[model samples]
Target chain A: MRFSVLILGNSSATPMYERHPTSQVVNHNEQLYLIDCGEGTQMQLTRYGIKSNRINHIFISHLHGDHYLGLVGLISSMHLMGRKTDLHLYGPAPLEEILALNFKYSETELRYNLIFHPTNPTETAVLFESKLLRVESFPLRHRIACTGFRFQEGERPAKLDIDKVAKLQIPPALINGIKWGLDFTDKDGKVHPSSELTTPAPLPRSYAYCSDTVRIPDYLPSIHRANLLYHESTFLHEMKDRAVETFHTTSFEAGEIAKEAEVGHLLLGHYSARYKTKELTLLLDEARSAFPHTDLSVEGKWYEVE
Target chain B: MRFSVLILGNSSATPMYERHPTSQVVNHNEQLYLIDCGEGTQMQLTRYGIKSNRINHIFISHLHGDHYLGLVGLISSMHLMGRKTDLHLYGPAPLEEILALNFKYSETELRYNLIFHPTNPTETAVLFESKLLRVESFPLRHRIACTGFRFQEGERPAKLDIDKVAKLQIPPALINGIKWGLDFTDKDGKVHPSSELTTPAPLPRSYAYCSDTVRIPDYLPSIHRANLLYHESTFLHEMKDRAVETFHTTSFEAGEIAKEAEVGHLLLGHYSARYKTKELTLLLDEARSAFPHTDLSVEGKWYEVE
Candidate 1:
C-alpha cells in the first residue's frame, strides 16, 4: 500500500509564474482526496497527470479566495466533461451558499450529485471515515472561520504467510481468521499459537493539513503525532507583526507548532508570492532552526507519508 | 494612435493545451478593455505582459463559468497588488450579487472603488461610451442569457498636414482648429478649405466580439461593417446539428454571418477543444468558402483594427 500527497499550488494570496495558490491532492493507496483547490487547479491536475475523476472527496480548509476560488471552476469542468460520480465536498457553511449562488447564475444543472459536509470552525470532530481512512477536523485561529483536516489511514490487515498456512494444513476458508491472528486447532486437537502463525499488522499512517492560520497552540492536541504535517509558512520571523495582524503564521511559528505537535516531518507551504522559488530557502532555514525535520513544499512534487 | 485587440483565450468550454476559454483585451489607443475573463485570465494577462492596472473596464458576455469565473480572482489580485483606480465592470445582474457574496466570504475590503453596470440580454443598446470609444451590446441566442459586444471607435479627429500648415505660416495655436476640420484663415481673410489643409480621417475603426453565440441574424445590424469581426465557430459544417443543439455556430455559418454583416475581416474563435492548432485550418477553409476574408484567431496574437 502507498500513501502520498501531491502539491497542486503553494503560493498564498496571488498566483505567480510557477507558484499558484493553496491546493494539494492526497493519494491514500489508490483513493484520491483534494484539499484547498485554488484557481488553476484543474490545469495543475493536468500538468501533473492526475485524473480528476479519481477524486471523490474534496476538503477545503477555508473560504479565502486563494484557498477555494477554484472550486466552482473545477466542478464546472467536471460537469462539462460528463462526470457522473457523486462528489463529496467538506467546508464551511457559507461555502454551500456560495456554490449554490454561482451555480444559479451559471444555470449549471450539475449532472452528478454534489454533497456538502459543513465543518464547524470552532470544534474538533471526525469529518469523514471509511473502511480504509478517517478524516478529522480541528479549529484554527484565522481572520475568518477556518479548519484544518487530518487524514488518518485505518490499520492495515496482517500479511498472510502462505507457507505457514500450508504447513498447518489450514482450510482456505479460515485464511482470513488466521490473518487476523486467530489460532488454529488441528483435527487431532493440537493447538497452534496465533502469534506464532502471523506477524503483527502495520500501524496506521496520518497526515495533517494546517494552513491560513495564526500561530496558536490550542489545536496542537488534535494534530499530535501526524506522520506528515503540512503547515502554512507565509512569512519570515521579521514579519511577525504582519503575520499576527493577518492571522497567518511565520516560518518560525510553523516550526514551533510542528515541534510541539511532535510530527514526524514538517512540510512548509502557502508561501507568499513575494518569495521567488530560489529565495524561499530563507523560510526553510528559519523553520529548520526550530525543527530539524522541516522541508520546503515544491509545487507538483509528491511526498510520501510513511 | 494604436487600436488593437489581444486574444488572451480562444477555446470554448474546456481550456486545452495552448487555448484557454473566452477572453480578450481590446486596446483602443492604449486604453484597454477586457472581454470575458476565463479561469486563467489574470495569468494570461501576465503571460502577455499586459499590465493589469491598465485595464479599467471589463465586460462579461454571459454568466457561464468559463466566461466570468475569473473576475473575482482578478479583482482580488488587483487589490492585493495595490490597485487604487476605480474598476468598472459591466455584466449580467447576478454577477453583482455573486461578487458581493464572494467578497463577503473572503472578507475583502477593496482599497479601490468597484462600480457595476448591469446589462439586459434581450435588447441592443449602448452599454459604455467615452471620449475615445463607444461599446454597444446586442443579444445572442444561447442556452442562457447572453450578449455580444461591439467596440466602435469615436469619430476620429482630422489629421493635419504639417507641410501645409508650415507653408501657409499658420500659427501653432490654430493647429487644433485645423485638426478639427475647421477651415484655416489668415489675417487677410483668405480661407483654406479643410480638405486642402487636412486629409480625411480614416473611417472610424470598429471590432465586434460575437462569441459563445449562434449564427443568428438578429445581431447583424448591431455589428454591421465592423473592421474586424470575431465570431464563435465552435464546430465545422459536419457538426451543424450539434452546433444548433448547443446553440453554437458552425464555421460555414460564421462565414455566412460575416458575409451578410459586411464585416471587413472575420476572425473565428471559441473553438471546441477537439480542434488542435493544426486542425483549425479546416475551419478557416470552410469559413472562407462562404466569406473569402476569414482567418483563424491564434492565441496570444494581436490583430490591428485597421
Candidate 2:
C-alpha cells in the first residue's frame, strides 16, 4: 500500500525562477490523482515522467488562473493521446461552464467522457469513494469560492495469523468470516473469538490539500490528524499584511494551522515568486517555528504518508 | 534594423520530448510580438529571458488548444505583474467571448486594457500596421478556421549621400525633404533631383508564419519573396497520407511551398512527436532535398530575416 504526495509545482501567482504555479499528485496504491492543475502542469508531469493518462481524477482548488489554467490543455492532450476512459473533474461550479466555453471555441469533441462534479464551498462533503479510498472536499476562505480536499484510505481487513489458522485447521469457508471479525464454533460448541484468530488491521493513512486560501477554522475538523497536510504558504511572516490583503496565508500561518489541526506532518508549498531559491529556507524556518515537523515542498519529490 | 524570429515551441498537437506546443516570438526593432500563444508560452518567454511586458501584441492563428491555451495564463501573469499598458489580441471572432468568459469566472478585472481585434480567415488583409511594421493575415487550409501571419518591414526612407550633401553645401532643413524624395533647386536655377542626391533605400525584410495546415496555393502570393518562411512540417514524407488526412503538411510539401513561393530561406518546424530527436534529421533531409536552403527550427534559436 503506497500513499504519498508528489509536488509538481509550488510557486504562487506567477511562474518564475524555474518554479511553476500550484499543482501536485497524490499517489495511493499506485493510482495517481491530480490536485490544483496550474499553468505548465502538463509539461511538469512530462518532465517528471509521470503518466498523465493514469490520472483519472483531477481536483481544482479554485478558478484562479494560477490554480487551474493548465486544465484545458491537459484535457486536450488526453484526447489527442487517444484516451477512451472517462475523466472526472471536481471544482467550483463555474469551472464547468469555463471548460465548456473553451471546448466550444476549439470545436473539440472529446473522445472520452468528461464527467464534471461541481464542488460546494459551503460545507464539507464526500466527493469520491472507491474500494480503498474516500475523497472529501471542504470549505476554504479565499477571494473567490474555493475548497480543500482530503484523501483518506478505507479500513483494511484484519490479517489472518497463519500459524493459528493452521493449528486450528480453520476451514477455507470460515476464513473470510474470521477476517471480518466473526467468531467461529468448534465441534464441541466452544466459541473461538475472531480477535484471537487474526491480527488487528493497520491504521489507514490520509492526506489533506489546502491551497489558495488564508488561514481559516471552518475546515479544521475535515483535515484533522491527517498523516500529511499540504497547506498554501503564499508569503513569509514578514509579508503578513500582503497575505491578508490578498486572502492568502503566510508560512507561519500555515504552520499554525497544521499545529491547530494536530496533523502528523505539515508540508509547506505555493510559495510566492518573491522568494528566491536560497530564500525559501527562511519560509521553512518560519513555518518550523510554529510546527517543528514542517517540511518544504520541493517539485518532483514524493513525501510518503506514514 | 533587427528583424528575427525566435522559436519558443514547435511540437504539434501535444507537448513531448521537452518541446512545447506551437509558439514563437517575432522581434522587429527590439519590439516583441507573440505569434501563437501555445501552452507554457509565458514560461517559455521567461526561460529565454524575453520580457513578457515588452510584448504588446499577440496573434493567435486558430482556436486549437495548443495554439491559444496559454493565452489566458499569459494575460493573467501580465495582470499579476502590474501591467498598465494595453494588450492587443488578434484572433477569431469567438476568441473575445472566450477570454471574457474566462476573466468573468475568475472575477479578474484586469489592471490594463485587453483590446481584442477579430481576424477574418476567409480573406487576406492587413491586421495591424505601425510606422515601421505591417502584419497581415491570410487563410490556410486546415480542418478548422485557420490563418497565417506575415510580418513585413514598412518601406524605409532613402539614405542621404553624405559626400554629395557636403559638396553641395545643402542646408540641414533641406536634408529631410531630400530624403523624402524632394528635388533640391540651387539659386543658379539648376535643380538637383532627389534620386541623384540620395542613395536608394535598402530592401525591406519580411518573415511569414504558416502552420497547422496542408499544402495550398491560395496564400502563396502573400508569402512570396519573404526573407524567412516558417512552414509547418508536422510529418515526414513517409507519412504523407496521414498528413493529408489530418490537414497537416509533410516535410517535402513544406519545402515545395517554400520553393514555389521563392522564399529566401525555409525554416521547418511543428514536428510530430513520432520523430525522435535523432530521427528529426530525416524530416530535415527530406525538406532539404526539395529546397536546398532549408533549416530546422530549433527552440530558443533566433533565425534572422535578412
> Which candidate's lDDT is highest?
2
Regions of candidate 2 where Cα sits further than 4 Å from its true position: A159-194, B159-198
RMSD to the hidden true structure, all candidates: 2.0, 2.7
- lDDT values for all models: 0.90, 0.92
Predicted candidate 2 versus true structure: per-residue lDDT over A188-224, tens digit per residue: 7888899998999789889999997888788899899
Q: What tens-digit string does per-residue lDDT give for candidate 2 at B66-168?
A: 8998999999999999999999999998999988988987889999999999999899989899979999999998988999999999987689999999988
State the lDDT at A280 in candidate 1.
97
**Interface C-alpha RMSD after superposing true interface residues, each candidate, one decimal:** 1.1, 1.1
Residue B54 error, candidate 1, Å: 1.0
Query: What is model 1's DockQ versus the real complex?
Result: 0.73
Q: Residue A141: error of model 2 in Å?
A: 0.9
